[model samples]
Target: MKRRWIPGCFAALLAFAATAALAASDDPSYGIIAKHKANSAVRISDEGHRIVYGSPKTPVAVEAFYPLRAGGEGHEWVFEYGYNLVTAFPDKVRFVAYDIATPRGGEVWQERGLTCGAFLINGKREVTVNGKKLSFLRSTTMSGWTFAQLKAAVAAEIARPRPARAAAPKKPARPAKQTVIHVTVPCGLAGPYGEIVHLFRARHPEIRVTTAANGIVAMLNQLRDNKMTSDVFIALGLRELDDPAAQKRLVSGSITPIATIPLALVVPKANPAGIHNLEDLTSPKARTVLTYTPNLSGGYGARQALQEAGLWDRINSKIVTPKVPDQCKQMLKTGKGQAAIIYSTCLKESYLPDKPPVIEKDLKVAQMIPQNLYSPVVIGGAVVKTSKHPAAAKTFIDFLRSEAAMKVWLDWGFTRLPGA
Candidate 1:
């Protein structure tokens, strides 16, 4: 009454079962579906998902919109994905991606990358969707999946209808207010600071920033006395932070370096004294202009460099102490001094060749002190704890460390901090 199954038939059935199980297990939504399902506020629709794929070595950024059921308004969520260059694969294969979401209007919250999910297919070919974990078929396993495939999968999942919920009462919207942040920095940083502030404003139009450029000592003294109306202080060196009074003004653990300006010698366009090298400054005819020692960062850097070259004492008597780096350049241009030592960025001609004639004329970088002989002047900043716009101040400070800000620093002939 019972028939025995053939060996080949039994093997075929087993293979079919394994394939079906693998297909059922592989869900490549990158955990977005589960996350949306769990959160009561998140409403996913077919029109709300976007995916952008990047070439190798670059990052992929995704923007997803989830409308709030209460207000029928939504916020865009940005997520980025890339390879983790610092941590090798199998240990930490993917760059942690974060989502920028505004919980309340004008207030932002950054969600951690892992909680959002990851598409890691190297050593372990797995996709995390919502809270459910799945893996790709072994036959289909690869180091990474195409952006198109992932996007299609996610789009299909998000298109499915879900249970509707009741709308909650909407809270009245508050009028947007502008936050003004006052920044104090050394005059030597005027060029880079201008560019950084401009870019920061462009990125955050709701926040207004004003900058005051003065000598570091004067700025520090003003900050100590509360005479300066500033929310951020950018100094020439870390030593400025060591001052007890200045330290108290800074928000704890907020000191961050932004850039470095190298010491350079500026000479007249005519090369009146024929000053070209460090040794050339020793000539009696070398009426050199210098920054005042100890107080001026550029002056201190120049003195250190000259001392290393064994030309400090020889040039000291000939020195004309200028109040600022700009003054040093002016002295050289006006023929008041044959040579001037200042921060390399002070001479616009050194980096900005296409600058206007009035600003670009009559001064050239004669020499740049080698890094081995003298260190560059560091530019750093900290948020004042007394700042009324402390959050905005911190955001501006953080922007100074962005790649766009670093480009501005580099364009002005200043050295960018590593990993900035």
Candidate 2:
């Protein structure tokens, strides 16, 4: 009876062992190993019941596989894994396992478990698991962590209590004050400068810019006499800086080019004289208005354009010289002249019919003076040495060269200088 009982018990034990082994083999983790084993791209082999897999195309150089047998339930499978050096994106290491189960009942190796960590080759401690928020371990040898050690590190981080955050300190009250940056721009630049100032003030509400439109020469003289307090001087030409008085007032090596102003032939809305181009200004019947202040860029540019077209003498004969380019626009609108040679920026401003007698009509820019004959007016600025707000002044000057400011200049009919 004893011998018969022993035989039956031994047979039962053998059957139970076979059933457990079959269950382990049927697990999703084992399915992933089997799938990779058949994949030509992944070189897989088994060592002591452990599935080892690697691929040159994969970021993971090599990884050892194991299943979290205790917690695995149906499609929900977890993996305890480890990897050696990652060839591609070595800083970030990810381990992924697959399963074959879906509500749609499709047979495919779907992603089952994934864990990622970062490491540095230079032996610094910056390893994070899953994301940067959950930093589990920091060591030089994180890449070499064993499966047991990696699992333990993750468990420790999850179980550890977070430290209580300290209360934030009260912020000090800010003083109610604004710094003013006095800037002198040419009369021809009033429109563009107004837009630029508006944008600058919007960005920096702490600084206030007081702008004055005057001849560049007059602005320089005021700087010399200390009559007008200015932080910056924006001139239409670099020649303005050549003045000994301006050179003395401005900081050395602070002059920088901003943009180039092209000359445009502006005509009245009706175009009563039928002047459409530079050649049209040569007509004896054409009453062409010319800017006279040669020191001002628009005045200089107008003369240059007419001289290049070989109509300076012919056109100059019918000239009604305005004090400035703004006056030139005024003369054309008031019917004092049919056409005027002025800065393209000035012509753009004339479109606004805000001022009465300035009708809402299409004042056309007939033609842009050829750049070959007369170069575009190159505008530049310098920080005055005597500025009360020197830092704010320099900040404003830098803003003038910004892409946003350059776009405003372009929209106003000026071209940005190369490297400006």
lDDT value, residue 34 of candidate 1: 41
Query: How do the residues 1-420 of candidate 1 rate in per-residue lDDT, one tens digit apiece?
Result: 124557677888999998976654442233333443354332233212222222223222222222111111111121222221212122222222222111221011111111111233322233455555453210111112344444433433334454664596696543388887777656456556655665786789889776544455556766676655578888876656767887887899989887887877778778878888889988777855556555555667777888998988787888778543345555565567888777666555211112221144457788888876766567878998878988888899889878899897787777876444
Model 1 reaches what TM-score against the true structure? 0.53
List the candidate 1 regions with Cα displacement exceeding 4 Å. 1-175, 213-217, 239-242, 349-359, 418-420
TM-score of each prediction? 0.53, 0.51
Worst 10 residues of 1 by lDDT: 105-114
lDDT per prediction?
0.54, 0.56
lDDT of 2 at 406: 90
- lDDT computed for candidate 1: 0.54
lDDT of 2 at 93: 37
The clash number for model 1 is 4
* Poorly placed runs, candidate 2 (over 4 Å): 1-179, 201-208, 213-221, 350-362, 418-420
